[model samples]
Target: MNRSNTTALTQPGAPMKVRNVSKRFGAFTALDDVSLDVAAGELVCLLGPSGCGKTTLLRCIAGLERQDSGVLYLGDRDVSDLAPQARDYGILFQSYALFPNLSVEANIAYGLAGSNRDVVRKRVGEMLDLVGLSGSEKKFPGQLSGGQQQRVALARALAPAPSLLLLDEPMSALDARVREHLCTELRQLQRQLGITTLMVTHNQDEAMLMADRIAVMNNGKVEQYATPQDIYDKPATPFVAEFVGQGNWLPFQRSSDSHANVGGMSMRLAAGAGQAASGRLFCRPEAISVNPLLHEENLFPARVREITFLGNRCRMSFELNQLPGHALTAEVGSQDLPRLGAQDIFVALPPESLQVFA
Candidate 1:
């Protein structure tokens, strides 16, 4: 949680801008002309798979690592060459990085080292309240749960009331259930306080759930940067489309900018799609309709290869007769399964639902 009702810890957020930044270590490139604009009070996630350079970019912004080239800005200030201690932002690492020997009070007050003792105590109390850990100030990191330790780290990061907040895999240490709850809480608090934040995460769900926008990275370069819905629905690259979520991909030859041929089956594509050439047609499983009556002409015979029930929903795996050997999955509500009892069915993949990448 990043919000605060106490004026002592609340401050207006500052925008962050990274302009044509690049970093490299030896022969390995870590960031490639990366650029991003994070508006004031917005949460942006640097999302990608492991070793994709998301962390490296975060480190460069935090001044933990020096960038080989390019500029960085926090609001109107150029902080490209500033060291970590001199930067006007607080970072929470994946490890929590809390001092095991220090009490929660001390850990959170570490950032206020030179402040008056009374002021430090008041700020620590305000931070503890902000994170919903008010009464646990005397507890050591080892004496608290994983989630609590994370809050202490968060409180420490926010204690300085920095205009920009940086998060590096902040919830990776918690169990799934706790991570989910804390994420929601943290997001609410971040919005409540209106703090600008940059988060680095490999988990797609976390990024999708909390980010106002996301920068999808791969191989030390930004693949696509946009809102989660835009990134998911209109991915700019094959890497972005494949990395963001589960989808059915089939090799096909484009008939034109608006049509594609998968095997002998004709599939409509988005207008102004890829060039007329061989490419892959992509569609998310959730976008596929199972035997819709309205799209009868586009429907194809399919056999249910498997059906997995997941509480409120079901994931149906299908083998389309027209595109055999291609993986096809459709996610439907559990209550809607009564109509899908038959092993055989007709499936529809609307033209507007597909992405063609040549």
Candidate 2:
């Protein structure tokens, strides 16, 4: 359904919807039955591994790439086949895509087509200031640093005040230092303007830090779309659970009741035991605790395999001799890390924290 006709889609007050959209390059499928929604003024980030059709989907929405089937709606307009310029959306690419000959001010003013000279000047000035690039308007693209050039690109995109903003890995081109600083600044700017924006990023940290909601895609399909917390906590599938965070799967033999023999350690299933299969148990690194006091239940013996010291925490891998083929990882506070080498460690695997899947 197109919301454009009801006067609600573009309301700045309304939402944007992407219907069952699919794109194929001859027999190769780039996007398969993808659909999602963004509330008015909401920021949604599309995240996935490379070649997962994220860019194709973003391009389709921007009118830069057409889909084989399904409709595209912006605020209430059916813009499935509209030209990129006609769609009235602003885009920022990974490379910044700034015109080398254009001065900072001109680059920003490029999108303000035919507005009065005074009006154009005012908008450009406002955007430059908003993006913290106030005095460098006359500098050409080559004169500015990479970060400054990016700010210019951003200023240009926002200058038009397009209802919808599309960003394709906008930070991938920047150095690490600039990328971190810009990520916060970009998010702040988006919130301040209240523009409904969609960004495509392969960096999980970027997605988690910037988006109000994230749509995790894989193999040309959206595996999950949810709040960053939900996507990390209650992943809908094994792929999602394994992909979103660090985890390990242990083999188990199913018992008559809900219990399973996880390796030689018979671990109890928390509630939905009946639904689990006999083969594997999903254990998140953070879910397992290595506290000194061991609880009577869920505690197991394991030898210390290796320990890597990370600034805030230490990552220790525990090798279970009972489960020869599997290993468990745990993150312990640097101060709480147990001395290893000669000492054996007894770890507690809370039943509630373990997820058993086929």
Candidate 3:
């Protein structure tokens, strides 16, 4: 809906806190002492692989699944024991949970059943307009495409103007192109509404694109909670580094606090490298330059075993001459491939870009 007309949807958001929440189903622990803070008007993403407790956590916050322990607070109020109906939040599931028999307008107006007719009508219209589905009010869920149905579900969730929004893999069913487009639209709308939001998704690209911060979860525990850039560039754990982006790991012997021997070469590492004598050295694929124009500290003679083009970039399999049996991958700009020849090719690992973990 247009901001000028929908006053209720513009209400300021509230903070949400999940404090030491834990849940278990028989022998499986879905959430193990999980906790996080969602600031007022902030968007946080619960990012992880399937069965990582992200969805379980979202359900707990929505009161659909009660935690076995801990408390939940919404805007300084204890909402731990409240029922789902009493929680001032709206949720949209992956399935887009619309009644096949109901029209789009009816679905959007479902939450306002007890409200006056005029109020419900106005709210439904505003929601449909806000989601860019203004003219499809009469269409049934069966008649709408997957993307359209997703927008309808979004409109339904916002109809009540809830203070918080919980989305569980909302765009997972859509095609890549549609998912990308809707991610932009949904993020813009959420910001405009100023609603605190938590979204669960296995897609790193979506989380990075939409969330102000991401909580990377693994095996029912939070591995890292930070901004998207921080999660990618300064991962707190090995699971986070491997999950959030593409990287290469090398088993190496630690020579000093800032040095390691990897791929049969002595390499300089960034400060804060772990102290373990033997550890794994991690470097993002993009950080490794093949035949770099600038001088590098850990440069070595390397051979390209394979080159796979991926539009703007090329993924090249690399093997250092000193470590012929070992392989590493380097991502270089496609346009720069012409500058290299069949000889003198080198792989440069910038010290400041390398991370060591035991």
Candidate 4:
């Protein structure tokens, strides 16, 4: 959608403040003193595995579920005690929740009741055009494809031009290709309208692709919150390091702030590597080079244990000679497989790539 058109249809976004929100059910705690702030016009994703309180937190914000203790504010208005309908936000569910009996136009115009009929009709048409479903106005939800139904639901949520948008796994039901396409479209639309949005998803790729910032939750608390790259490269916790992406963890004994012993082989640590007496060193598989250049340091010998072809790249498993029974895997280009003959291979682990955590 065009910028001018989007601005004309939607109101300026508002910031949402959440302070020390806590929720519980009987003996179980769903949210544990969680706090977050969503800036105006920013898109943030609550990301974690299932049952991690991401959904519970989103529902709390929407008033679908109330928090036992916390303060919620949309801009300057305190909305902590307001009912769902009384809050200034619109929500799109994973199921789309479109009225199956109603036509596309009717669904989009549902929130426009009590207004001028002509104005509602015009607004519905504009929403349909904005979501690229203008020609399907007469079609029922059941008649349209999954993607189309989702578009209709999105149109409906945007029809009233709410200041905040809440999406709860909105694309999970669609196929992979369709879900990816919709993610891109949704991000573009959100940016064009400058709507403050909060989304809940367990999919790492989805959060990384769409969110301006991500809050990684674990066991009813936010473990870390930062941009996608920051979360991946400099995770604040070991769980965040392992959960967000693939990494190799090798047990190490620290001898000093700048040195550690991995499998009895002494290696220099990266600058600013925490002063842990002993811990595991974390490094991404891609950071380990199969064959070392002459200038590379920390070269170690390992034997290829197995090889698996994965379309464009090959995954090779290696047994580190110094650390028997321990294995490491690396992603290598398919074309370079021949260079790795039937013999021991040397791998280089760059110091800067290693992160030591106690």
Q: Tell me each candidate's TM-score.
A: 0.95, 0.92, 0.96, 0.97
Candidate 3: 10-residue stretch with minimal lDDT: 1-10
Cα lDDT of all candidates, in order? Answer: 0.89, 0.81, 0.89, 0.90
For model 3, name the residue pairs that clash: 1-130
Off by over 4 Å in 1: 1-8, 272-276
Candidate 2 lDDT (Cα, 0 to 1): 0.81
Q: Which stretches of candidate 4 lie over 4 Å from their true place?
A: 1-4
Residue lDDT tens for model 4, 81-147? 9999888898999999999899999999998889999999999989988988878889999999999
RMSD of 3: 1.5
lDDT of 2 at 307: 84
Which residue runs does candidate 2 get wrong by more than 4 Å?
A: 1-14, 256-258, 272-274, 294-296, 338-343
Error of 4 at 224 (Å): 0.4
- For each predicted model, how many residue pairs clash, with residues at least 3 apart or on different chains? 0, 4, 1, 0
**lDDT, candidate 3, 232-251, per-residue tens:** 99888889989988988888
TM-score of 1: 0.95
Pairs that collide, model 4: none
Which digits, one per residue and each the tens of the lDDT, describe model 1 over residues 74-139?
989999988788888989999999989999999999999999999999889889998889889888
